[model samples]
Structure formats: structure tokens, C-alpha cells
Target: MKPAHSEFPAPPAQLDHDNCRGVASILSRVGDKWSVLVIMMLFNGPKRFNEIKRLIGSISQRMLTLTLRGLERDGLVTRTVFPTIPPRVDYELTDLGRGLSKPVIALGTWAMDHMEQIEAARAHFDQRNDTA
Candidate 1:
């Protein structure tokens, strides 16, 4: 007994160029700022929840929870829980997540190399668009 909305519209099994475009749209979900930071932190090794919180500084508890959940759902990150007097949790990048590191690192490098130029372009664009 499945509800209509509950079912997912998966990309068709037939190999097609459009399938690649559809997957790109899906990847955008995990490519946001917080998700990228979470993956970068795990690029070194596995880390505990609090450790990741400290590493990412400014992220609120709620946001960290949400971002981790999304990444986990996408199989980009894995969460482990240990049974003990006090429950413990840890997160790490899966192999797919690790695969994204190179591209993310390249983006970081590009940002560093072009930041000044980008800022200048933004200033010019803003000035050109200003009504006043």
C-alpha cells in the first residue's frame, strides 16, 4: 500500500545523455556550502560530531544535523553510532564523497587564484546595474 507522492521518479534505466543531466541536478543538492565543508573536514579522516562542529566553527547545531542528514541520505557521508553509557556518533566521507574532494579542492584553488579579479568583476557589474 504505497502513497502516490511517496514513490520516487527514478531516472529511466536506459542509458541516455539526459540521464547525465538528471544526475547533475541531484548532485547539486550535496554541492551546497555546508555540505562541501562537512566533506572537506572528513577529507583528512573520520571525526566525531563535536570535532566536526569545532572544525566548522559558526555552524549551529540544527544546521549541522540537517546537512549531515542530507549527505548521509545521498551516500556521500556515513554516520556511525556506538552503544555506551553515553551515546557517541561520528561522520566520515564515503568513497563517493572522497571522489568529490579533488573537484572541491580545485574550486578552492580557483577561488584563491581569482578572488581579486572576481571582486573587481562583481564591483563593475554592480555599478553597471545600479539605477542610481
Candidate 2:
């Protein structure tokens, strides 16, 4: 007799067009350079807006604001405001955001480990393309 697992056909690996578009949109949000950096910075703990900006060092205030807003909208981040003379605001990863950390970190680790190979591949491709 066939195995029980063989009773069902294997699922398609590729998403249908509509599903693909939806996934692509989410990937674009998460895969953007600034989002990755922001997420990584928050992985340590909560941080104020300026702290995130200072650590990232090159993002504009507008861009940072947009990024944080997007993350908060997506339910990946939480923003808290404190009562004070000037008021203090902080951003932290929510459970959903923390869930994203592992995959993001793995992507970063893989990039770091293979960057040399990627650069070599790029150089080889460029040299070949230049000859052509």
C-alpha cells in the first residue's frame, strides 16, 4: 500500500499571482535596508527615536519617522510615550516583531558569511560582461 503521506498531492512551491503580490509587498517592507537596521537595533531592547537615528547615523528624520510608523502599523512595533517635562517616546518590538528577528538575523548572518563569495561573483560577472 502507498504511504499515507502519498495520498495527498504535494503543494505547489510557488505562490499564485495574487498571493505573490501580497507576499512581495510584505517582503519589500521588511527587506528594505532601513527596516532591517531598525529592527536589528531594537532587537537589543527598546530605544527612543533619536537613539535609533543616532545609532543608524545616516537615515533622515523623515525617513526614520516613516519607517517606524510603517512598522507600528504592521503590528511589529509598539510606541510608548512617557509623561515628562518634554515627554519621552520609545519604540520596542512587539511579539510579532520579535518573531521576525530570527529570520532577519539569519539573513544578516548568511549575508555576512557569503559576502566575499558574492563580491567575487560580481567581479567575475563584471569582467566577463566587460569583455562581451
Candidate 3:
């Protein structure tokens, strides 16, 4: 049994070419694993490029650079250059980027809270399929 709203519409939500393409484009960018992590890291405050890499640990230098560039292009992150002995650069979230943080943090919290349940469900599904 399902509530009225729980059931999908007859044809489901619109999946016209333009709609699908637009959604996929954005999802491909922000929905990437590294993008999410990078966005989360910048939520605290502006961080140097190296600082972000060190904190995120597993991400490679190339990937981080790409992520930052993409975010900057999307107008979600601002890159600042400080004139000093050598040079210094920092990345901070823009207003739009900060707006993105709220939902991302909520999602991260939900994943942490439900991890055990998700793992249990995975195990159950695997066992059932194994026996089939």
C-alpha cells in the first residue's frame, strides 16, 4: 500500500530532452564525489588550495584543481590571489555556493545517521540474492 503522493504520476515527471540534459549537466558537476567533498570543506571558511587538498586527503591534486576550476566557473566559488613573497591563493564559497552548503550538509548528516541501516539493507539484499 502507498499514499497518493507516494505513487509516481502516470507518465512520471517530465523527462523532455532539454529538461533531462540540463539536470544531467548540473548533476554531473555538483553530484560528483569530489565536488561534494570540496564544497563541504569550503563551507567553514576560505582555505588555501593546499589546505583543501590536505583536508580532503584522498583527492588527487589534478582532481582538486579541476573541481575548484569548475566551481569557480559555475560562480559558486571565488578564488583570491594575495601578493606576497611568493604567492597565496584562497578559495571561498560565494553566496550561491553557501546556499548549496545547507542541503549538502544535511545530506551528509543523513548519510552518517543511516549508514548502519544502509549497510544492513545491503547485506540482506546480497544474502537473499545469493540464495536465489
Best by TM-score: 3
Instruction: List, residue by residue over 1-132, the lDDT tens digit for candidate 3.
Output: 956774545654667999889878988888888888989999999999999999999999999999999999988899999998688999999999999989888888899999999999999999999999
Report the candidate with higher lDDT, 1 versus 2.
2
User: In model 3, which runs have C-alpha deviations exceeding 4 angstroms?
Assistant: 4-15
TM-score of each: 0.76, 0.86, 0.87
Per-residue CA lDDT of candidate 2, range 1-132, in tens?
956798667877877999989988899989999989899999989999999999999999999999999999988899999999799999999999999987898898899999999999999999999999
* Ordering by lDDT: 2, 3, 1
> Model 3 scores what on Cα lDDT?
0.92
| Residue-level lDDT tens digits of model 1 in 1-132 | 965774657656796788888878767866788887888789998999889899999899999999999989988889999897698888988999899877887777788899999999999999989956
Q: Residue 80, candidate 3: how far off, in angstroms?
A: 0.8
Which ten contiguous residues of candidate 2 have the minimum total lDDT? 2-11
The positional error of residue 20 in candidate 3, measured at the CA in angstroms, is: 1.9
Indicate the residue-level lDDT of 77 in model 1: 89
